[model samples]
Target: MPLKGSDSDDGGNDDLARLLSGKHAGKHRRRSRDADDDVNGFPRLRSPRPRDEEEPATPTSRRFQHRRRRGFVLCLRTPTAVVLSSAALWILFYALSLEGGDLVSIVARLGILGAYLFLSIALFVLAVLVAVFAKGIPRKTRGGLLAGLAGTCVALLIYDHDESLYHHGGYNALIFALVVMPSLAVGAAEIAIWKWLGARRAAMCHLFALFVAIFVVSARLSRAAAIWGRGFGGETMQPLARTCKPTKIGLPWVDLLPAGAQNFWAGGLTCAPAAKPFSAEIDADGALRVKCPSNDATYIPLPVTREWPQDWKLVEENYEGKLPQPFNKRVMDAIRRTEPFRIRGDNAPGMLVPRTAEAAIVTCDGVEKLVLRARRSNDTSSRTLRPPEQMTGSRQTKTLDVIVVFLDATSRRHFHRRLGRTVKKLEQANADGRTRLFQFFRYSISGFSTGPNSRAMFTGTSPNNLDTVSPVWEDFARARFVTAITADTCQDWGASYNPRPAFHFDHEMYAPFCHADFFAEDSNPLGNFRGPYAINARCLKGSRVSDLALQYAGSVSSAYPDRNTFVLAWLLEGHEGTGEVLADLDDGLVSLLGSLDWSKTALVIAADHGLHMGLNFAFTRNGAVEHRNPMLAFALPPWLADSEGRGETLKANAHKMVSGLDVYATLRGLGKVVDPTGFDDPDVRKRAQGGKNLMEEIVPPDRLCSDAGVPQWYCECY
Candidate 1:
């Protein structure tokens, strides 16, 4: 298209040619331009000539000129391009997540393991098929692109699977910048290099440019990895409490008590003289929990750190070659999938404990103290009450005291909101300066209400299953340990699936107290219910019901100081009204803990779920949070508490999603920990198929809701 000669009459085109001809070429440019050469399709220009003699350029020629700047054109007859591009994107996404790229997908939110398998298997197969069958693109070009795709896939497959990545579903543009456009660009460079990338110097320049592009990509990837590491922990990944958006009061780091709206006379369990009067105070346990603490009596707590008693022989578990059973599908769906939960008690008649603690007192009427044993003989228990035949020599083994303090309708957040003082006091309690109370922030619920949830938690099976052989309490009893349970209401008893829990216990405080029904008209504190144990009914005959249970349990524990005991006190005062009333009972809780024989006591202060009612509608959304996020705190002495032993594992697991099954599993293992030969029976020695001990075994980071026996509907962690 250039002219052969130049003249004054050549016009503007000639002038432009004249301007560029001399400086554009080297000394040999004139000689070399005599003939046309397709050197990597690089354009060539001749010395200036007359414009009248030059040939005009055509559209095709103009288009061909761009060939040097572009690479191979990947023409396709089918949607091969679309398929490969899509696969590439998927591979990129996975790679970023695995390699800590900009688009890291957290295991908790993405169910990363399952999704990773899908991408690795499905996408990889699809890509291979496209590579083999697709037509139109050059073989070399196809091979090169396929190589890149395969490399990306392999790289992703081998990338470390770290569950620490917190959920952050953003960074889509990174995929384009990393894979899509760069792909097109690399192809162009390849085509230019393979076809004659100009002279040696020009080829080197193009090579250098490609190297720079690669360096930039590597730098970007490094930055992405850094971002991934920064927000990995549950504590580091700040929770976005959408419920607090309008109120600006849900920040966790700041004081959360004010958020409870406790200033309302309606809030916080008040200890003021009752507006009305009744009797029955100053019981010994009551004295320990209330009077003694109020009067500042010289507190003498039981020694917690001591060698195992010489009289009680220690038993050891045997597990030379055993494996835990896997959870099956049927149990996973015991509840619906993908729905949220509610925290409450449904309509359940009562438990099947013999005539209640009332019978022990020689009258159908209730007594202030109905003393009884916690474990019932199997012969007296219903046929459903079968324990793994009292795990070989369990009776001879010495066990630790296991006390469970269950707070109905209490969420972890609500625990913080209502019992901030208790939380602080427990946090301060320690073994050699290490924290004593391990709080499980990621604890989740298995049901909306009390019935099914209790069954799941107590039995470690589907909540729907009516019959269970090893209720945790029963297991303790079978192992020659004393077990007892006291509750404010019978509706939410752990074994609610039965019209009356099929299996009966040795002692019965719930039935006796509830059936006693000693109440002042309209005194119920639990909302509209006017009888007994309502959200608003703070006291029964002037004694705080919450403190009463604690005192009773303490008294029972003291009754058999020589033997290990398992007592559960289900407190309900903190069960409703934003649950702020619990704040008033913090002192009682501290006193109870102070009196415990920490040396042998392993306490679990947990809740089935939270009660979302009470307070203003501002907390309506916050109520949803309370629904699934129940309170789960484990208070163990330095020795047994660190069964994760190092504290590292326990601390890590506290952040991962935990459920009732894990608690059940932990209970099952206590026998082995306390009395060596305790619960290591052949059937249970391998651990329950669906449960895991939170303190001992580490829960897999990639564990799914189903894996933990949490139905999809009730699953809130992911």
Candidate 2:
């Protein structure tokens, strides 16, 4: 099409090439208004081209032809202009990444920003007049524009995220109206000035000027409507109006001690001395009663009181009616009955006081001594304080959203690095801090001790402090958290470990021997690469383990409500590195994830510790030196998937080493509070519990692997 009326005027399909062609260059260019040029320059038409060479037509006929042609061309151009402008606006809106809600908000907020923009443009136009007389005006003008661009870039780097830029669909269209319209207005004014100054040609400049004016008017009108619609739609709530939920999961008891007894148990001691064995028993009324079993135990009884600390209350209905306080018979027996001692003297409070003389109340001197105290008491001054009760918040204005993607264990280093990087990206994307979330932990089973006691205290803490350690307790303080909620184990025992190979938490294992599904890391392991739950009595002799896993996931998902507070558990069955494990986990995991409201909860999956596959392919010798196993799988809420600091790349495959500890930092980040107290463990503490160091420590640049083969794949395996 030719540049004007004919197809040739618009030129060939090469739009850009046709635009720059010399044939229509004059129309697009500005006629230089030099000192010699007239205000309305006219050229003599080739000396009238020898007057006789031209033919003349009747006035009426000529007038009719001109009017008809003009009408035809105008009609054609109108639709073309509308189509081109609409397409351009759409591209701009998409590039800017606008969403519908954001678009509406922008329109509403636009009024606030629009007034400033208009005033700014007016000032800019006014300043042009001043610039005409000022020396070095061009340099100053360029400097100001450059400075604005620089500031925008910096602000974006500091606070903007990919997620925020997106509007569900038409949001950005709304934003385009708010932003583009005013911008075009300013641009049009500049173009018009250039045209009048003879710096640009009237034809091309006029076309562009037309384009800008039309868009500006259209965008402003559209954006205004969007903004007004949303504001008029509803009322807004303050952040404080929202309340929190019960943060603690399982309730643990708090301990109290009798009066004066505190002094007798001091001196760096944990229990009462053997000489003065203090015993406690729950009375018929369910109140705790204490007795001194020491000879010459004439010490004053301390004031003993009971108070439920906070979160450690029974959640079930069966154990109602105020479950026996901490000093119950079970605890009393665990403390004193195990130790042997005989009382030689009465340390009882009543035994220390003297009786009144002949039913007459005899009062002593000003001191009014109530008793003549006995001697030879054992001094115990140490006191033990119980952990506080669980914390609760009012109804939440926001809820924690979660996504857990369990990955196969490959290279230890690669896994850890990938795990850490994924978590960092997820946290950065959720800067809103309105959600409480955590990723699957990257732990190995070998690091933990076995047996009922060890299982009860299951965690990756030093052995010496097992009785006093609880990672979950710390996590509750940092983020409302739960782990190993699944019911699968990743370990595979051979004929040697157990003749009739048993699952990690089989009926037998969950009996008196060990009932620690919540605490044990292996309680919920991943499925073997090939089949369902490791053991299915219903299956025939040779069923695939992957099938069992899938069935189990289906059963569990079906058993629970899709919405509610509960942990969905999974155990990757088997320690082998066979490819089957990955396939099985993915299938089962995909199913489980599909069943939840990912926007309101989080999913975390990791191993207790990893197991070593024997070269012989049968369970035999255990490997002492463990690799830095990768902590596989972490998913976050969809909204947070694009938060700032979330790296540009995403993990695609199943090979990377990511540290397990990143779990703590990731959870802290999701919880929205920069400093989470529970991450006080030496490792996570330095980052999360302190300052803004969590991002630095958890998502250091080294963790991202933007290599061609794995743009988001970390390869730090040994």
Candidate 3:
């Protein structure tokens, strides 16, 4: 305590009262007057002046002064706590998201952190500045400071919309909703909280920590449930080719052409040419081995297409044309001359006498040829194989006419090029053959591919070598003389371009003709022919389309069409995502199949590839890759099964691995399609070996030929 009136000299009369109490107030006042007279430094022993000379200060004024000082102190401590707490919370939430936390936890953490940080920081900085510098200042000073700080925060949110802050760990929506919006609300609350607390730093700190703790608990539980409760394998993706060794070996019993068979120079089935031939071999490790000769065909014709046979489209085209010295186009020329029909239908005459109805033959010549029978057609009976000459049911016994339907359902542009080359080779066989010739032959190719005039393979010279190459639609269309109808197909339907658009999956218009007769069956003969047949390599070959047609045309009024003479069509719908197109094609097939006469018609369903839809890779390797399975199916006429001259049966443990190319061989056995060798091998129907045969295990037992009710040739439950 320095002399009370000594300091009071600077503060005015009010400070004199504050420094002195009771009797000291009067003494202090008297000394202040005397001290003023001395003035230079501390008062010397000044004589006491009369107290009447001093004036008194009011208590209200003194109280106001003290409050102003206290307010300043509170502002300093409170604002700092608010701001620091806010910053810490923001950092915590950011870290959690970056650490790959569960989505629910990430969101909850963000919300809690945002609330704490915004409230604390906003209040702290504003209150401290106001208390420190704005004492007795205009209201505009505090308002301007707070408004500026808030504006800065708003700008941050807008600027960060596209930043990683918004998208980290799949938190795009959460950031915008929780972090950004709640920030504004918390900011306002913080300003109010600071002002009410009079810049109490301790209170703001407590509030922020309390908020954070509550959210932390909530976030932890949410994260736990999101991560551990549900499985991540719901969506299975295809494994990358890099992970697995590509297996090139097909079934041994099936006798499939090797991957790069063109380089092979074989004298017979087993004899190799004396010269070393070029070939491609794929080892078990998914590695490719290619041996090239010094002089080889250089110009490999690459097929370009606009639309893929299915929903796929072509986006790129690349080809290098290199021509080698004339190796005989003669072998190719010879095969071109020998044309054999490759269609899906029946091709032989029946030997069994009908017990229920007259026998008939719906020939490919558009003539309904009738076979006078000794018995009714409806009788549960057998039919023997009639000689080729006896198929006409006439004295002259000419070759019988039969229609063949070919489906080329490929969803990718690459497959189109391959299938095109196969068709062209078939035309070559036609040009080379002299014995089997037909006048009214038509091969109509329809599906989604790149174009109407494209070939199916990358090159006709050595196709097996080009299996690694991607396919295009035009390659297949131009290969054979057959005409094709391609839809607006492409390689990819912009799935990579804009994945989240409202209507991203709109490429559903490329399905084949939707007809009921082709797939379904009604009682009408002429009006029921409708078909849904589009080609997509991605779908489950012929069976998928058949199933689709069944769904579209099936109803309570009629059962599936029982046809014997009609050749129905098929489309791979699932591969293309063409929902409407699939529905239409199925309806078309049903109507078409229904209109056909069952007694004189035969329908066959087939597939090019089996999809790997059932694998549970997520259980083992997480969601990684997709694979393809082998094709499988077989059909025989009901009449042939009852009256077979020799009752030959397919193997019991059939691997059920039927190759798509085997359809051609099967046609040759039926005699409707002509093979120059005219050789029929019963063993062709043997199951493919190696993998578990999906068809053998899945097909109903009653449908097998070995069943007592099933005919030898006809494998059906009925």
Candidate 4:
């Protein structure tokens, strides 16, 4: 059908092609303006040509013809305009690249970018002026106008992406968005002038513009891709020093490497004495408890009634995979009997949560695996729940949201291997100078296995029989924290490792269900992977238990946005195998790490130990090194890092020999916990007994494995 204003050319079924050539517009420009026909301030459009044959010369026919003319509308998009816009953009990008891509430089180049940004205001006023004063356009013509602009945008973006691959290092985001985009608008306006002359000439002009675009984009894209890809490559997190003790005899580069490999020095540090910022120790017989809040008030109400959260299925649904949007009845019906538990947790899992879920054991489909719904309903964190009234605010010098994740049997190298997605994203954020996570290059494990090592971090000592102590959580509780919660699939921790009364957390979640299911603590290592706790082949139901815990934590954050939360999660996915299976968690891990509210949050991600059970990984030389040295990383508040060179401080500390006990000290500092009795580690004028607070102090440069609390058998200080 012909467009209302261009009856001659719009009759063709090549509207998109016509739009590219700037036809189907202004065909009736020869006609005089008629104010009565105008809609709002826009001039009403009419066909430049009359009908081939007149309808009956009656008033009724004439009225019908006018209505038909008013209905047709079209976008006046043009390809020639796109070509001109491309030219102007190249100059802008070149200027931006020269100016260091900084804020001040950008403002200077944009002319109207200073404080008042008068240019932007003027543009806004100009648009308003056109909408208010311009005549001869119907209200629907505005949609057509937007379409014309949108068409130009689509063409530009397509050309740029295929040619530049901006993020793939073709052009930095700054130059691409700013210098190149607006040029298209300028080009589009230029072509509108040509269409005023006639459609035939404009269509002919599009051919020349097309040939030029093809030639220019082809000439530049290849060289730009090669240069930028090298300059702005993807980031890579190193698993270990490039040349470990036994592998130091070769060249650094492997020639062909993994995608996004840029950091040549991330693995530069050797097992040599390396560098130590500072270190000290205090004489102490046992680990010191976390300091309570300044007020030292307890917030636990008398009736501490407990129940599963209402939004458990929200997380359960995510675990089952991203549901299609719009959740139509058809979509809902398709997923009715499957995962996601749309109606209720128990309904979806087909199992009822036990009243005293702490001790109840259950199975999934007769196997020792749990349904995702079961995890949310039974195993998720509880003490972390804070009442709305308590969620008011904190009165501390600083209130940092703390997240502690204990990854079982994952080494620093293994972490880089399995959770590469999370690692790369955090690194990219770090590169952009945003809030991000960082890993310590020399975080040595203080204990042999998951339980003892983490216990040393949590309680400040890894004792065999002395399983009880003033747990670190008490300090958070006494501080009147809004919420403090821990979640684990098994009831007791350290059972597979230490073999004691199930090491109790403040609350046990999802343990009974795991027990009733096909829960086998490494004894039934069915597949190749093996350490212990490989329940139902490393899954609760069909989802990885790690993902369940991760999603649960995300849901908790979503469920309680206003409250301060302390989340402690134990991930057992890597414990039972070569841990290669952990690769599956890359996407989930990426989401969890990036989802945090980092402004006030403090994140700690550490592994208790590396590969231990698998003979292949455990017995190898590098494997042994990885086993002894676990990963410890922290994501502190962005402001703290920005002030006092603290980011640099963390980097320096990362290279120092540290262990879980030191982590205990750091936790005490972060919580701003004060021992109620005003006790300090004993200062004997000798070595410091307690672990060093990483923020306030550091482990001694020449610190030995024994000094840091690593037992002789597990020590690999070399």
Candidate 4 wrongly placed segments (more than 4 Å)? 1-399, 462-467, 482-488, 494-508, 512-537, 643-645, 673-688
Which is the better candidate, 1 or 3, if ranked by lDDT? 1
Which regions of candidate 1 fall more than 4 Å away from where they truly are? 1-268, 271-399, 431-435, 464-469, 490-495, 499-502, 515-537, 615-620, 642-646, 680-688
lDDT of 4: 0.46
Model 1: lDDT to the true structure: 0.50
Q: Is candidate 2 or candidate 4 better by TM-score?
A: 4
Model 2, poorest ten-residue lDDT window? 506-515
lDDT of each: 0.50, 0.30, 0.28, 0.46
Best by lDDT: 1
| Per-model TM values vs. the true structure | 0.48, 0.27, 0.25, 0.45
Candidate 3 local lDDT, 78-197, one digit each (tens): 433444344445434443334323334443454454444445444434443443343443466456545654554455445332212223322232223333444556656766766666
lDDT of 4 by residue, 1-718 (tens): 5655555764544665767556434323212223344444334555555577644455544544565465433122222223234334433443233322333234244332221222322332333334333454556754454455445445544543211112111222222333223544555565575658577777777778999988866656444323211211232222333222322111112112232232222221111221221111111111111121221211100111123222211211111223232112222233233332112122212223223222211222222222222122223234444344443544333445677777778876567655766777777666666675556766778755666787778767643424445445545654433333434443333332333323233333443223322233222212222112331234433445566567655554443454444567767655642344545556667878788777767778878887664332423455556677676778777775666565676655666678888888777666663222222333223222557777667455567667777776666543
Write candidate 1's Cα lDDT for 1-718 as tens digits.
Answer: 3344645455657777766776576435533542353332334545656898755574444544564355334222233564566576677555544433222233132344334434544554556545644555557757876787767645543453222122111122222223334445555555556556557766787789889978966666454333321211113222323222222222222122354343243333443454422122222222212121122212111111011121111111111112131111111222123132111222122122232222121111121222222333343333323244433464433346788888877776566655756766675665334335566766777766665566666667655455544567767766556666676442324333433324445444543233223322122211222223243445543456666667667666665565666787877655543355566567768778778777677888888887644332112344555567788877775666554473556666766777888888777676556554445433253233667787777877666667776777666642
Q: Which stretches of candidate 3 lie over 4 Å from their true place?
A: 1-570, 577-585, 612-627, 630-634, 642-655, 672-718
In model 1, where is the ten-residue run with the lowest total lDDT?
312-321
Deviation of model 3 at 217, angstroms:
31
